[model samples]
Target chain A: MTKKVATREAYGRALAELGKKNSAVVVLDADLSKSTKTADFAKVFPDRFFNMGVAEQNLMGTAAGLAAAGKIAFASTFAVFAAGRAFDQIRNSVAYNRLNVKIAATHAGITVGEDGGSHQAIEDIALMRSLPNMTVFVPADEAETAGAVEAAAQMNGPVYIRLGRAGVPPIHGEGFRFETGKAVVVREGRDAAVIATGIMVTVALEAAVTLAKEGIEVRIISMHTIKPLDVKTIVSAARETGALVTAEEHSVIGGLGGAVSEAVCENHPVPLKRLGIQDEFGESGKPDELLVKFGLTAAAIAGAVREVVKRKG
Target chain B: MENSEKELAVLKAAANEIRQDIIRMLGTAGSGHPGGSLSAADIVTALYFKFLRIDPENPKNPDRDRFILSKGHAAPVLYSALAQRGYFKREELLTLRKLGSRLQGHPDMKKLPGVDMSTGSLGQGLSAANGMALAGRLDSKDYRVYVLLGDGETQEGQVWEAAMASAHYRLDNLTAFLDHNRLQIDGPIEEVMSPEPLADKWRAFGWDVQVIDGHDMNQILQAVERALTVKGKPQMIVAETVKGKGVSFMENQAGWHGSTPNQEQTEKALAELLANKL
Candidate 1:
C-alpha cells in the first residue's frame, strides 16, 4: 500500500521543526509564500523568515550571505525561478563557495498542474546536480520530503531539495533514515527492477503491483538523492535483475534515468529502458491529466518495464 | 600615529609575503592566474591577517568573521593566505592546479579549510555573501561578512541585482571589496566593458562606497574599518590596483590574466617579487 501525504505541507512542518532546533536555520521566500508552503513556517517563526518579493536572484544571493554569516539558510521559491532565474547566483555564490544554503524549490515537474510548463521545474535536478558540492534531493512523497529537509539541515554544505506542489502518495514513515547516497528498496523482486525518483516512486510501486499480477517480478527502488547518486544500490540492482527501468517526473535526458544509466554503464551493463518525459514541454492541464498526457503514469512505467524485459531477451 | 605606523609596516611585510607566495605557487604549478592573484594579494593579506577574526587552527569556528573571494581565479592569493595562516601546510601551495591537488585553479571549499565560498565564475559571490549576511541578522550573530569583487566582474548584471538587494535589506554587516584594476582577461576594462564612475554607481545603489589605492595597506584597512563603523547600509571599497602588481614584467599586462609564467618568466617574476622584500 502506498502512503499518501503532501510534500509542500511536509516541507513547512519540517522547516518549523528545524527553526526550533537550529537557531541558525533561516528561511527566505520570493513572494509565493502560501503556494510554496513556507507561510506556515513564516507564521510560526516570523523573525527568521524574509519575503524577498519576486527577485529569485536576490533571494539566492541573500541566502549566500546568510550562509557566510554562519547561518543555515533555506531559500524557498518555485523550482523554476530558483533553478532557472538564479542559476548563476546558485552556481557561483552558493555552490562555488560551498555555503550551507538549502534551496527548497516547490512546484517541481508536471505535478505543477494548472500553472503550466512555465512554473513547472523539470530541469532543476539536472541543473543543480551538475554543480560541484551540490547535494540534490527529490523525495518520493511527504514523509521522505520531511526527512530530506531535516537531513539537509544537518548536512554541512549546500543542498537543493525539489518539492512537488500537488499532494503525493506517502512513501516513507517516521524512523526511516534518509541517507544522502543510499537508495531505499521499496519492494523486493527478481525479474526486473523499476528504479524511480521523486513522485514517480509511488507510480512505480503501483506499476510493480500490476506487473506482479502478470507474473513479472518487479523491484521498486526509491532514488531520492540524484547527485552523490546511490551507485552501489543501482549497480547491485542492475546485476541482480538483468533488465532495468528508470522512471522519473523529469526530462529523460539528464535526470534519474541519466543518472541510473551512468552508474549501470560504468559498473554493470544491462538492458535498460528510461521512463520519463521524452524531451517535450509540459502544457497547462489538471495534474492527473498532465501525468497521463506526459506518459508519467503507472501504465507508462509498466509499459516501459515490459519493453525492457523484451529487450533483455 | 605610532600604532598606525606599526600596523602599516606589518601590513606591508605581510602583503609582500603574500605576493611572494602567489608568484612562487603559480610558478610551481606552471598554470595559474598570476595577474588577478598578484593584484588582490595585498587586500587578501590584510583581510586574513588583519580584519577577519579567523582561527587557522579552528577554521570551522562558528563565531569567526567570513571572507569570500568572489573572483576565485585568484586562488593563489587566497591559498597563500590560508596556508600562511596555518589552515594547511605552506608546502601544499606548490600543488596548485595539479591533478588531484587540493589547490585547484579556483577555490574549492571542500578541499581547503579557510575558503568560505568556492568561486571562479564572475558576479555570483555577492549573492552568497548576501545570504550569509541575512543569516547573521536572523541569528543575531555579530560576525561580519566580507567579499572581494573583480572590476571586470561588475560588468555582470547579477552584481547589480545583488547590490540593489544588499541595500534594500539594509545588510550593514556586509562589506565588499572591488579590485578595480581597470583590466580583465581581454585588454582594459574600459575597452572590454565600462564600469566607470564605479564608486558613484555603488553609492547610487544605496551602499557606503569608498575608493582607495588597493595596494595601500593603510587605505585598505581604513576603508574596511569605516565600513564596519557605518550601520544600516552595506559597504563597497573600490580599491584601484594594478594587475600583476608586484612582478614588473607581468604588471598591467592583459596576457598574464590566465597565463602560466614559463620556466624562464617564472624565475624572472620570482626574482622581481623577492627584490621588493628589501
Candidate 2:
C-alpha cells in the first residue's frame, strides 16, 4: 500500500529543511502559518519568519520587498486569499518586478473540504498562470511538492506553488527527479494520453489502470508545472497518442485542460476532453464526497479518456 | 547634518528643474499625471539629492539605499529625479509614456536602471518597501528603504494592510512619505473618499508620524534626518502639499491632477518656473 502524504505537509518540511542550508531564506504568512505549514520553518528560524496578520496583500508585498533586498522570500497563505485577495499585489509587486518571491499557497481546489466555496481556490491555477513572469507549479505528491518547493527557492524570479489539503497516494518513489517545465510520464501506453496535475494525477493513474483492464492502454503524464508549460512533451503526447484527456482538481476553464488544449491546438491538434469542476464553485462536503459529487473520481477520468479516444476515430 | 544656505539653493534649483521636467514630459507625452508629480518634486528632490545614499554609475549596487514610488502615477517626479541624478541621460525624459521607451507610464524596474521596485497599481509600494526592510534585517544590511505614497492612493485597502505589517515587523529601516496633495483624479480626496485624520491613522498603525510642508526643502531634509533616529517603528512623514506646486495656474487645481499641459501652457508654466528668484 502506498503511504499517503499531503503535499502541504511535504512543502512545510521542505521549507524547514531549506532554511538550514540557505541563510537568505525568509518566510512570510498571512496568519495561516499553521494551515499553510510555514510554521515548521517559523519554529526553526524565528528571526526570518513574519506573520502579516490576515493581510494577504501585505504578505505578497513583503515577500517582494524581501526579494528586492536579495533574500529568497517565501510567502504562504490559503489559495483563495493568496490568489484572490492579493492578486494585484502578486501581479504588480512580485511578477511584474520579477522578484525572487515564492508564493507557497495551500488549501487549493475542493479538497479543502468543510470550509466550503469561500475557502476553496478553484480558480487559483487560472489566476496564477495568467501572470506574465510567474512560474506556476502544481505538485501532485509529497515528493513533487518537496522538489517544487526546493526548485522554487533555487530560482531568482516569482513562483506560485499550489499545494493541496487532502493526502493522496504517492506517485513518485525516492528517486523522483523534479525539473521545472518538464512533465513526468508515469505510465506509457499506445492508445491515448491522460494529462493531469495536482491531486488529479493519482486519480488519472487509477483511471489508466481501469482502462487497461478494458483493453485500453492510456498514457499518464503528470504535468507539475502549469506555466512555462512543457509544450514539447504535450505536443509529443498528442502526436503519438492521437488523443488526450486533461484532468485537474480545478475549473476546466483555464486550468491544466485549457493550457494543454491551447498547446495542442497550436502545435499538434488532438481530440481532447477536460475533466474538472466545470466553471462552477464548490460547496461544503467531505473531501471524498465532494470528489464523487463533482465527478472527480478515477471513473470520471476513465470516462473522459474513453470519450477522447473515441473522438480520435 | 543641517542644510547650509548654499545647499538649500541647490536643492531648490533641482526641484525647480524637476518641475520643469514634469511639465515638459507631460506636454511631450500628450497625456500624463502632472499634479502629484509636481507636488512631490521637492520631496523626491531631497531624497535623491541629500538623503538617499545612491550611485548613478552603479544604480543596482546591492548596498545602495532603495526608493519606491508608491504613488506610481507620479512617475514623472521619480523619472526627473533619476535623470537629474544621472541615472540616465536627461534627454530620455521626453520619452515618457512613449512606445519602446525605458520611461514607461509607470515605473518599470526591469527596463529602468535605478528603479528599486516596479509600481503602478496603488497601495502596493509600502508592502514591497516593508519586505526590503525585513530583508535588510535578515541579511544584516544597513541600507534604508524609502517609499512615497499619494494621499488619494491611501484609499486602497492594501495600503492599510501594509501599514499594519510595517509596524508589526518593527521595520526601523523603512521610511514612508504620504504626499498629502488632497486632490485625486475624481476631485478632492475628502469629497471622493475622506482619508481625513490621516496622521492619526499612521500613528494608530504604529508609525512615528511627522507632519511637514512637502515643498520646503529644509523641512523635507529635517524630517528624513529625524526618521533615522526612530528605533523600532516605521516613520510616516505626512507632507502637506498642493495638488500642483510652482506653476501659479496649476497649483491647488483639481483639474490639473492628470491633465497634460498644452504647448502654450507648457511654455507659460516653464517661463513662470524659470522666473523664480529662489
Candidate 3:
C-alpha cells in the first residue's frame, strides 16, 4: 500500500518551511487557521500569522494590502469561501491590481464530504481560472502541493492553489521536479491518453493498470497547472493518441474537462470523453462513497477510455 | 503640535482649491458623486498637504504613509489633491472619467500614482488598510496608514470585520476617517440604513474614537495629531460633514449625491467655492 497524505497537510508544512526561508512571507486565515492548516505557520512565526476572524472578504482584501506593502501574503480559507464568497475582492484588489497574494484554498471538490453541497467547491477552479492575471493550480499529491507552494511564492502575482481534504497517494518518486504551467506525463502509451488533475491523477494511473490487463495500453498525464496550461502536452497527447479521457473531482463544465476540451477542439479534435461530475452538485457522503457515486472512480475513467477508444476506431 | 495661523490659512486655501477642482472635474465628466467628494475635501486636503509624510517624486517610497479612499466614488477629491501635491500634472485633472484616463471614476492604485490601494468597492478598504498597518508593524516601520470611509459604507458587515481585526491586532499606526455626511444616494443615511451611534460602534470595536466636524480643517488636523500620539490601538475619527458642502443648492441634499452640475450650475458652484476662499 502506498503512503497517503492530504494536500492541505503538505500545504501547511510547505508554508512553514517557506516562512523560515523568506521573512517577507506572511500568512492570513479567516478564523480557520486550525482547519486550513495555517496554524502550523502561526506556531512557527507568531508575528507573521494573522487570523482575520471569519470575514473572507476582509481576508482577501487584507492579503492584497499586505502584498502591496512588499509582503508575500498566503491567505487560507475553505475553497467555497475563498473562491465564491470573496471573489470580488480577489478579482478587484488582488488580480486587477496584480498583487502578490497567494490564495491557498483547501477542501476543494466533493471530497469535503459530510459538510454537504455548500461546503463542496465544485466550481472553484472555474472561478479562479476565469480571473485575469491569476495562476490556478490543482496539485495531485503531497510532493506536488509542496512544490506548487514554493513556486507560487517565487512568482510575483496572484495564485490560487486548490487543496483537497482527503488523503492522496504520492505518485512521484525521488527528485521529482515541479514547474508552473507545465504538465508531467507519468505513464506513456499510444492506444489512448488519460488527462487528469488533483486526486484524479492517481485514479487515472489505476485505470491505466486495469486497462492494460485487457491488452489496452493507455497513457496518463498529470496536468497540475490549469491556467497557462501546457497546451503543447495536451495537443501532443491528442495527436499521438487517437482517443482521450479527461477526469477531475470537479464539475465537467468548467474545470479540467472544459479546459482540455477547449484546447483540444481548437488545436486537434479527437474522440474525447470527460469523466467528472456531470454538471451536478455533490451531497453529504463519505469521500470514497461520493467519488464512486459521482462516477470519479478508476472504473469510471477506464469506462470512458473504452468508449473513446471505440469511437476512435 | 498645532498648526501656525499661516499654515492653517494655507491648508484652508488648499482645501478650498480642492473643492473647486472637484466641482470642475465632475462638471467636465458630466456625471459623478459630487456630494461625497465635496464633503471629504477638507479631510483629504489635510491628509495630502498637512498630515501625510509623502513625497510626490518618490510615490512608492517604502516608509511613506499610505492613504486609501474607502469611499472611492470621491475620486475627484483624491485626484485633485494628488494633482495639487505634484503627483501629476494639474492639466490631467480635467481628463478625469474620460476615455483612457488614469483618473478613473474610482481610485485605481494600478493606474494612478500615489494611490496606495485600489478601492471602489465599499467596506473593503479598511481591511486593506489594516493589512498595511500589520505589515508596517512586522517590518518595524513607522509608516502610518489612513483610510476614509463613507457613513453609508459602514452598513457593510466587512467594515466591522476589519474594525474588529484592526483593534484586535492593536494597530496603533492606523487611522480611519468616516465621512459622516449623513446622506446617501437614495436618501438620508438615517432613512436608508442608519449606522448611527457611530462613535459608540467604533469604541465598542476597540478603537480610539474621535468625533469632529468633517469640514473643519483645524479640527481635522488636530484629531490626526492626537491620533498619532495614541499607541496600541487603531483610531477612528467620526467627521460630521454636510453633503455637497460649499454649494448652497446641493448642501444636505441627497439629490446631488451622484448628480453632476450642468455648465451653468458648474459656473455657479465654482463661483460659490471661489467666493468663500479663505
True contacts kept of each: 0.89, 1.00, 0.83
Report the C-alpha displacement of residue B246, candidate 2, in angstroms. 0.4
Per-residue C-alpha lDDT of model 3 across residues B47-142, encoded as one tens digit per residue: 999889999999999999999999999999999999999999999999999999999889898899999988888888998999999999899999
Candidate 1 wrongly placed segments (more than 4 Å): A1-5, A52-58, A61-65, A68-70, A85-99, A129-134, A171-193, A205-221, A225-244, A262-271, A305-313, B1-3, B82-92, B99-102, B246-248, B260-278
User: Which residue pairs collide in model 2, if any?
Assistant: A65-B131, A65-B132, A66-B131
Q: Model 1 over residues A1-313: C-alpha lDDT tens digits?
A: 5645678778988998888888878899999999888898899888888888777887888787777667788999989899999998888778877888999998889888998888788788889989999999988887788789988999988999999887777676566888887899999998899999988898999899999999999999999989899999998898898899999889988989999999999999999998888888888999999999999899998998898888888
At residue B211, give the lDDT of candidate 1.
89
Enumerate the candidates' DockQ scores in order: 0.52, 0.91, 0.83
User: Each candidate's TM vs. the true structure?
Assistant: 0.86, 0.98, 0.98
Determine the iRMS, in angstroms, of model 2.
0.8
The window of 10 residues in a row where model 2 chain A has the poorest summed lDDT is A167-176
lDDT of 2: 0.93
Clashes of 3: 0
DockQ of 1: 0.52
Question: After superposing candidate 2, which stretches have Cα over 4 Å from the reference?
Answer: none
Clashes of 1: 24
Q: What is the lDDT of residue B12 in candidate 3?
A: 90
RMSD for each of the candidates: 3.7, 1.2, 1.2
Residue-wise lDDT of candidate 2 within A1-313, one digit each (tens)? 8779999999999999999999889999988999989999999999999999988888899888889888899999999999999898889888988999999999999999999999999999999999999999999998899899989988879999999999977898778999999999999998999999999999999998899999999999999999899999999999999999999999999989999999999999989998999889999999999999999999998898889889988
What ranking emerges by lDDT with the best candidate at the front? 3, 2, 1
